[model samples]
Target chain A: MVQIPKTPGPSSPAPRPVPTSADVARLAGVSRATVSYVLNNTTSVRISEPTRRRVHEAAKELGYVPHAAARSLRAGHSRLVLMPAPDFPVGPLYSRFISELQWALGRLDYTVVQFGSVGLHGDEAVRAWAELRPVAVLVPGAGLGPQGVEVLKGSGARAVVTLGSEPVDGAHALLMDHEAVGHCAGSHLHDRGRRRIGVVVPREHGLESFSLPRLKGVRDALHGTTATLTELPLAYAEDSAARLAASWRDLDLDAVFAYNDEYAMLLMRALQDEGVRVPEEVAVIGADDLMLGRLLRPRLSTVHIELPSGRDLAELVDRAVRDPAAAPETHKVLGATVIHRDSS
Target chain B: MVQIPKTPGPSSPAPRPVPTSADVARLAGVSRATVSYVLNNTTSVRISEPTRRRVHEAAKELGYVPHAAARSLRAGHSRLVLMPAPDFPVGPLYSRFISELQWALGRLDYTVVQFGSVGLHGDEAVRAWAELRPVAVLVPGAGLGPQGVEVLKGSGARAVVTLGSEPVDGAHALLMDHEAVGHCAGSHLHDRGRRRIGVVVPREHGLESFSLPRLKGVRDALHGTTATLTELPLAYAEDSAARLAASWRDLDLDAVFAYNDEYAMLLMRALQDEGVRVPEEVAVIGADDLMLGRLLRPRLSTVHIELPSGRDLAELVDRAVRDPAAAPETHKVLGATVIHRDSS
Candidate 1:
C-alpha cells in the first residue's frame, strides 16, 4: 500500500469537517430525533430539561446549526419575510421606520430579506419574488393587483401584505393616507393668511403616485377658501432650486409646501440666496418633522407623520403567516399632524 | 372500498395546484432534465432550439417556476449576496452607494439581502448570518476578525468582503481611507487663512469607527502649522446644536469642519440662528458635496468624495465567488477632493 504524504503543518487533524446534528446527538448520547426536538424546541414532544441542555451543549461544542433549507423543507415553510425595497428616495424618517421593522422581525425569529424590485413591476415582479417561496412578503409603494397576489399565494407564500395609498383586494393592506398630509400643510398655510400657495412636486420618477395624491389633497383643501394652489415641479438639484429661485418674483406666492424637510431646506437656501426672506416673504412648510428643521433659522414648520409601531406590524405578519387561510385584513398605518414653527 | 363524495364546484374543475417543472416537461413532450436546462439557461446542456422553445412555452402556460430554496440546495449554494445592515446612521451618500450596489448585483443575477445585524457581534453575528447559507457576505463598517471570517467560510460562504479602515487578514477589504477626508478638510481650512479650526465629531453610537480616524487626520495636518484643532462632540439633535451654538463665543473658532454635509448643514443653521456670521466670522466646511450644500446662502465648502462605481464592486464580488481560493484583494473605494465654496 502506498503511504500518501500528509501536508506539512501543525499535525492537528485537518480541521474537522463541518459537524452535523448527528454528531451532536452522538456526543450527547441521544438520538438525532431527540436532538432535533430539543434544538428546534418542538413543544409537541416532551423532553427532560437536563437532556435538552445536554443536546444544546453538544451542538454548541460541535458548532452544529441545522441547515435552514433542510429545516424549512421539514416544516414546509421558510422563515424568511421578504420586504420589497421602495424605489424612491428614502428619507431619514423612512430609513428609521425600516430599521425598526427589520429589528422587530429579527426578534420574532424571522429573517428579513429586502427584495430589490427596482425595475421589475406587477405580475412579473410577483413571479420573481414567489420563486423564493418566502413565508411572507411586504410590498410597499408599488401597487399589487389581484392576480399578482394569487400567484404569490399559489406559490406557497403564506402572508401577502401591501402598504400603499389604498387596499388591494386579495392581500392585507396598510393604507397610508398621504393626501391628508398634504391637506394638513395646505390648510395651515391658508389659516395663516396666505392666499397663494406653491406645492413643490418632486420631478423624480416613481414619486408621481405619491405626489399626485398630495397635489389633489392640497387643491381639495383650498377649494372653498380664497387661497389658490400652484404646482411647482422641482428636482433635487442645486440648479433646479436656483432656477426656481430665479423666477421667484414672476411666480408670486405667499407660501410653499416643499415636498418634505429635505426639499424644503434646499428651496429655503436657494430662496435666501436670491435675497428672498423666509416666512416674511414666502412662508414655507414641509413634512417628516426632521431635527434639522428645528436648527434652521426660522425653524421649519412641517406636517408631522406617525407610522404604525414596528411591533404591531411584526405581530400582524406573524398572525397572518400562522393562519394563512384566514380572511385578509386592512389597517391604516399612517397619521399626520401639523407642527407650527417659525417658518409658517 | 369506501366511496368518497367529491365537493361540488362549477362542474368543470377546481383550481389547480402550482405547476411543477415535471408538468412542463410532460406538456412539452421532453425530459425533466431538458425543462431544467431550458428554464435555468444551463450552458452545459446542449438542447436543440426547438426543444428549448417548447419547454419555455409549456412553462409559461403552466406558470412553473423552479423553487429558489430547492434549487439552492440542489446546487449546493444560494445566489444570495448578504450585506449586513450598517449599525451607524446611513447618510444620503452611503444610501445612494448601497442602492447602486444592489442594482448592479441584481443585473449579475444575485439577490442582495440586507441582514439586520444591529445588536449581534463577533462569532455570534457570523453564525447568525451563516444560518441563511448566503453565497457571499459583505460586512461594511463593522470590523470582522479572522475567526468570524473562518466561521462564515466553514459554513459554505464562498466570498467574504469587508469595507473598513484596514484589511482583515482573511476577508477582501474595500479600504475607505476616511482619514484622508479629514486631512483634506483640515488642510483646506488652514490654507484658507483660518487660524483656529474646530472639527465636529458626532457623538452617535457606531460612528466612532469613522469619527476617530477623521480626528486623527485633522491633528496630523495641524502638527506644524500655527493653527489649533478642537474636537466638538455634537449629537444629531436640535438641543445639541443649540448648546454648541450658545458656547460658540467661548470656543472662538474661525473655521469648522462638521462631519459631513448633513452635520455641516445642521451646525451651520444652528450657528446662523445664534446670530453668528458666515465666512466672515466662521467658515463652515463639510464633506460629500451634496446638492443641498450648494443651495445654501453662502454655498457650503465641501471635501467632495468619490466612491467606487457599483459595477466595479459587483465585478469584484463575482470574481471572488468564482475563484474562492484566489489571494484576497484590497481596493481603495473612497477618494476625496476639496470643493472650496462661499462658506470657506
Candidate 2:
C-alpha cells in the first residue's frame, strides 16, 4: 500500500492544498467569517440555515476539519481538562477511576487529555502543561506547590485540582489519605496477637509517594504496642520475592503487610513454597482487596480502599469552572477498612 | 484556599497579563524574533551564549512558556504523536506496552498525547483526532478503514499506523493477531481428549473486537474434529460465574476457554465451590498467562501472548515519519502459545 507523502506538503507546488475556511467561503459564496461561524457552531452568531448547509457541504467536499488548537487559541478559552499521565503503574482500581473521570468530563462537554509527563517533575511538569493552555488541570499524587498553582492560574487555568495525600494551597483538593490503609492493616494484625510485624515496601520506581506514607502509618499504628515494624524492601519480581521468603524465618516476623494484593500473592506463593504455614507461622495481609485475594488458599485478608466516585469529582470541577471565585474546596476522598479472613 | 477568579480574565482589568515572547524581548532588550530564536532553541540561527542566557532568564522572570499550539500552527508542523485512549480495559500487559512506547517516544523528542475518544466511533473519531493535527498516530485493535486513513492523512498526519488484526489500506500495520490465542487454546484442549468445550466470551463493552476474532479462530480449528464448541457469555462478576458454575452439570461441557486469566480464575473459583473438580469434571484454560495463574491451586493453563517490543514499534514509526512516501509496511507483532499447567 502506497502512502501519501507528507514531505511535499503546502510547500513544493501544492498537489493538494490543505483547505481553509477561506476556500469554503469561496465555494459557498459567503465570507470567511460566516464560514467560521457556521463550522464552529458559534451560538453567538446568527446565520441562515441555507448558508450553514452550503458551508458544510463545501467543507465536506474539500475534506476540511476545523483545527481545534487554532480555534481554541483564537477564542482565548478552551473546553480542555488536562491530566498528566502518572509515571507509575497505578493498578486496575485507579485505572477504572480515570476511565470514569474521562467519561464524566465528556458528558460535561469538556475534552479530556492525558499528557505524557513520564520524566517531567514538579514545576517543570507544570510549565509543560501550561503550554497547552488547558482550561483545567488535574495534578495527581501531591507534588504541586502554591507557586505551581499560581503559575497555572496566571496562564488561564480556571481550575487547578490536586488528588493526593495532602492539599496544595490555591487548588481544589481531593485528599486521598493513603495512611489509613496501612493503619487498618497494622491494627488488625496487632490485635491478632502478632508481636513482630513486617511491611513490604516495593522497590519499583515512582511508588515512593504511596509506599512511604503507608509505611509511616503502619509504624504509627504499632508505635506504643509491643509489635515492632520491619521495613522489607522488595522489588516486584519473582526472584526478589523468592529471596525474601527464603530469609523469612531468619527475620522472625510473625506477621507481614505485603504492600498490595499483587505483592501479597507473589510473596504468599513464595512463602508456601518455602513450607511456611500461613496464619499459624506467619500471618499475611494485603491492601486493595482484589477479588483474586479472596480466592487464595488461606482466603487472603486485605485493606479495602474506597476511592471517591469520578462523577462526584467531575461535578466539583464543573462547579469550579462556572464560578472560579468560589473558595477552593478540600474533600476527604479516601476510606480504608480491613477485611478479616483466614490469612490473618 | 481562595481561587483566583478566571472570569476577571484578560478582558477584565488584567491581574497579570499572560506573558508572551514580546514581554520576554522587552525584559531582555531584544527583538521578539531574537527571543523566539533563543527560547525555542533554534540552532539554525546562531546567537551568543550570553544572549541566550539573557533571553532565558527574562522568560523565566516573566513566567513565560510559549504556547505550543500557536507555535505549531505557525510552523505548519509539530512533533506530536497522538493515540486514542482505548475505551476498554486493555489489561496490565497492554498497559505496560503503552507505558514503554510512551517512554521510547519521549526519548526521541516527540510529545505523546492520549486523546480521549471514549464515546466517538468511525470517521467521527478520526475527525476528532485530525482536529489536533498530530504528526503521527498509532491506532490499536482493528476497525480503522481505508477512508479513515485517507481523512487522517489529509489533515496533516504524516504516518498512520494501525496495530490490529489486519493491515489497513494505506496505513503501516502492526498485526496483533488475537485469533492465534484461541486457536492455540482450542487445539490444546482438543489434544487433551476434551470434545465438549465451552469458550467464555466476556460480556464486556469494547471487547467484541478481540473476542469475535478469537472465537472465529477456535471455530476454524475444531471444524472437522469431533469437538463441539459452546459459546459461554460471562460477565466479569462473581455472581455471573457462580450462576454458570451452578448449571455446569446441566450444560455437560468437559472443558472451557475462559477469555483471559482473570475470567478463568473467577470461573475456576466458582466451579471449585460448586463441588466440581478442575481438569476432571471441567478442564479450564485462559489467555494472557498472568503470573497469578501459576500461583492458583491445581495451577491454571493459559495462552501466552507476546507483544512487539515498544522500542521496535517506536523505531518503525520514526522510519515512516521520516519517509512518508515509502510503501506501507506490515509487521506481525503478536505471538500466542499454550502454557500447559495442571488445570488443563
Candidate 3:
C-alpha cells in the first residue's frame, strides 16, 4: 500500500502517548505475560534467551518502561519503602543518619520513598500509606499507633519498623532510647561534681517526642544525687537565648546539658556574651558531638551517640520482608557516651 | 431445603484478603462506576445523594481505600510531586525550607514523594522517577539535565520544575542565584576595607554544584577590586578545620566568607582557638541568617537569602500542571542580601 504524506498543521504539538507493555509485547510477537516477566526480570517461569532479548529490544525501541503501579499489582508487592516524613527540626546528626539509611536501602535495590505525612494522622495516615501499597513502612517518632501498624500489615506491607520510645504491636521496633542519652549526660555532669544542673528543652512542637524522654532520663539519673535538676524551657531563637542569659545569675545553675550541640552553642554564646566564664562559672555540655562543637575556644563538651549503622537497619528490614511469618523483633539502636571537653 | 449451621473448626488464621472497590460496589448495590465516582468525588457524572451515601457506607464498613496506583492509572494522571533527594549535608535553614515546601504541597492536595537519587544518575535516575508516573517532578540541586527532563516528559511527567543555577531546556527554573549570594558577600567585605578575603569551599561531594557558582560570583565581584581572593578548602570534619586553623596565620587573609552559617561558625571557632581575634585580625561572614549566628560572641556576619515561600512554589507547580502547554517559565526564587553583624 502506498501512503500519502500530509502537510504539517499550524496547531501546537500534542503530548506523545506513553508506550505500554502490550505495545512492546505486540512488537516482539510475544504474550503480555512474557513482556511483564522479561521487563520485571521475574525468574519463576522459563523463557528462551532469544525471546527475552527480543522483548528487551522491543521495549528499548518503543521507550517502554513497565508501569511500576501495574507491575506492583501483578506481583502483589512493590519495591517501595515508605518513610513517614520527619515533621520536625531534624538536626545534622539525624539528617546524616537518615541519608545513610536511604543509601543502605538503595544498595538493597529498594526505592526509599519519603511519604509526606505532614497533616495525616492515626488510621487516616495509615490508610493513605496503604493506598500507595509500599512493601515496607518506616514510621519515625510517635506517628503510627498499633491500629495503624495493623492497617499497614493488612495493606500488604511485609515490614513495618517504628522508631520511637517503644514498639507498637505488629511492627518491628527501632527504639531510639532517648532516656539513655539524658541519663548519660546527667551522670556525667554528676561525676564532674556539678550540682544545680539545668537541662534545656527546646520549645519546638515536634521535638518534644525526643526531648521529653531525655528530660525524664536526666531526672531519673539525678534522683539520689546532690545535683538539683532544673528544666530550662528554651526556644531556638536569639532573643530567647538573650532573655535566658539575662537571668542566668538568678537561676544559678552550675552546669547545663543544653539538649544538643546546636542548642549548646547558642546558649554558650549567649552566656559568654553575659561575661560568664566557661567551666569556671558554668559548665556546658551538649549531644551529637558536631565538628563545630570541638572548634569552640573552650571546646564544647558533648554526648557522643552511637547509633546502629544503616546497614544493620536495612538488613533487618530485608530479613523481615523475606520472612514475614517470623515474630516482629525490637532492637535498641541508640547508645550514648559523654565526651569531656574544656567547657565541662 | 433444610438450613444447617456450620461448626467452627480449629485452624491457623489465613492471610486476610484486602477489600476492593468491587466489594464496596457489591455491598452498595451499585455499579463499580457509581462507587468510583462517589469515592473519588468525580464531578462529571451525577449520582443521587442517597446512592452516594450508600457507597460511602459500604466502603467504610469494608475498610476499603482506593489504591492510589490503580486510581492514577484510571485517571490518566497522579497527584504526586517527585522531588529528587538532597544527598548533601543540608543546613537547618534549607531543611526548614524543604519541610515548608512539603507542607505547602500537602495543602494543595498533592503528595510530595522524595525520590532517593543518590547513586542513580542521568537517564537511569529519570527512568526510576518516571516509573512511578508522577504528575510533576521537582529536580532539586543539579540532578536533572535537559535530556533527563525530556525522558521524564516522555514517561508522562506533565511538569518539571528545576531548582538550580541555570534552567535546563524544557523545564521551569527556580534559579537559586548562588553567584549573587557570593557577589553580595565579596562586595560587602570589599566595602569594609578588607584587602584580602578567603572564601571557604566545602570539600563535600554534592555541595560543589552550589559552591562552584558562588566562587565564580566572588571572582566576578572582585574582578577590578584591589582585594585578592583566596580559596580555603574545608571539610565537614574536626581534623580538617583544625588543620586549616593552624595555617590561618600563614594564609594572611584579612576576611573570610565561609560557605554558610554552619561552616562559618565552625571556621570562626577554629580561628578563635588559634588566638585569631575576630574583626581585628580577620573579619568573617557566612550565608543563611540562622538564629545561632546571632548568639555567637562577635555574632556571625551573614548573607541573608530570601527563598521563594513554599506556598508560592507550590502554587506555581499547580499552575504549570494545570496549563502544561504554556512555554516553560523561569522564576528567580532566591534573593540574597548581606546581614552585617559584629564579626564583619
Best by TM-score: 3
Better of 1 and 3 by DockQ: 3
**Per-residue lDDT tens digits of candidate 2, residues B1-344?**
21222222222232355787888999999999999888788989999989999999998898888888888898886778999898668789998888888888887878888888877789988998888888899998665899988888778887899988889988888887888888999999999999999999999988988888889878877989999999999998889999999999999999999989999999999999999999998899999989888878779999999888777877778877777666778777788899999999
How much does candidate 1 score in TM-score? 0.90
Model 3 spans with C-alpha error above 4 angstroms: A1-12, A44-50, B1-14
Off by over 4 Å in 1: A1-35, A43-63, B1-34, B46-62
Ranking by TM-score: 3, 2, 1
lDDT of 1 at B31: 90
Error of 2 at A307 (Å): 1.3
- The C-alpha interface RMSD of every prediction is 13.4, 7.6, 14.8
Query: Model 2: what is its DockQ?
Result: 0.34
Looking at model 1 chain A, which ten-residue stretch has the lowest summed lDDT? A1-10
Residue A256 local lDDT, model 3: 94
For all predicted structures, in order, the TM-scores are 0.90, 0.91, 0.93
Per-prediction DockQ comes to 0.24, 0.34, 0.27
Residues A1-344, candidate 3: write the lDDT tens digits.
11112222233355688888889999999999999888878889899999999999998888877678988887888999999887677777777777878889999999999888878778877888899999999988887887787677777888899988888887888888999989999998998899899999999888998899999989999998778999999998878998999999999999999999889988998898889889899999999988768777688999998877777788888877876656768777788889999999
Local distance difference test, candidate 1: 0.84
Question: How do these models rank on lDDT, best leading?
Answer: 2, 3, 1
